[model samples]
Target: SPHIVLSTLTSYCPRSPHIMSAISKAKKSADDARDAAAQVREVLDKIRSALSHHAHDTSLLVRLEGELVAPANDVIRMKTYTETAAKFAGHLKELSEKVGERIQLHEDTPASQRTLNVAFVARTKRNASQIKAVLCQAEDTLDYLHQQALSSYAEVVLEKGARVIEERKEERKEEQNRQGKNQS
Candidate 1:
């Protein structure tokens, strides 16, 4: 009777708590990531909207293209902006790669007899594509973000470098003056 009772208790012990905990953690992570992705997606959407509005309101896009082709003072500014934009663009791209790795991790989960279903595979494929599309747009938006960030950085660096060089020149002049006074 003791052995029978022990066996029954063990058999009846709930597996739900452990399973639920895992599911809860996964759900929390999914929600957090989705929220973050939504924020980034909104940014990308706004950028696209702004570009469309600009093109609609003015022929800026067309005229800008013409200006871009001609050799002018703007070329240096453009090149500087381009370099900065590339750096931000790289950061955005890195974020996209993280999303992709997460998606692949989800897709790679092994099927089990206790929870196996064809729908799981279907949904996984659908979600992967949707997330991939969002990531791609994020990469595209990086172009604008990079340009803005880089242009600002370039300006700051130029200002700082010029000031530093000027300060060094002044220091050299001061040293020469001290040397001349000593000689006199």
Candidate 2:
């Protein structure tokens, strides 16, 4: 009886492309997000170092602004990946829930029938557990990406604000120099 149940479960457990595809896509997205985050970090570091040494250099600020564009684009890409991952996680959660319901139904059957379905229910439970694990991983990845994007955006805004203030100060200094010359 056990052998028959094992054979039946094995035969029915054909690998589902949907699960594999979701996993592959999630992995790729996560890799991309990591790369993007790294890029953002690198750019921010460079900006920080340059600012420390050349805070009054307008040309350096311009160059840093140009450098920031790539990281900003990376952040946008990360945001997109995060959204896609969220959708994928939602779908996986639904599938997991359905599997759980199926397991419960099998368990609720009459004792004689439940005995026969024991292996099947066990396999379903295992699958459901795996789905939950993947779902949790997806959520974690989404949160990470979201935080990176927000952080990058904030840094960029602050850098731009600093640049604007520096430019204004330079303009004011020039205006004062011109006034002194005229008065002389």
Best by lDDT: 2
User: What total of clashing residue pairs does each candidate reach?
Assistant: 3, 0
Candidate 2 matches the true fold with a TM-score of: 0.39
User: Of the candidates shown, which would achieve the greatest TM-score relative to the real structure?
Assistant: 2
Candidate 2 lDDT tens digits, 25-79: 4445555666665665565456445444643233453465457557546555454
The reply for model 1, stretches above 4 Å from the true place, is 1-137
- Give the Cα lDDT of each candidate: 0.43, 0.51
- Give the Å error, residue 168, model 1: 0.6
Cα error of candidate 2 at position 130, Å = 1.3
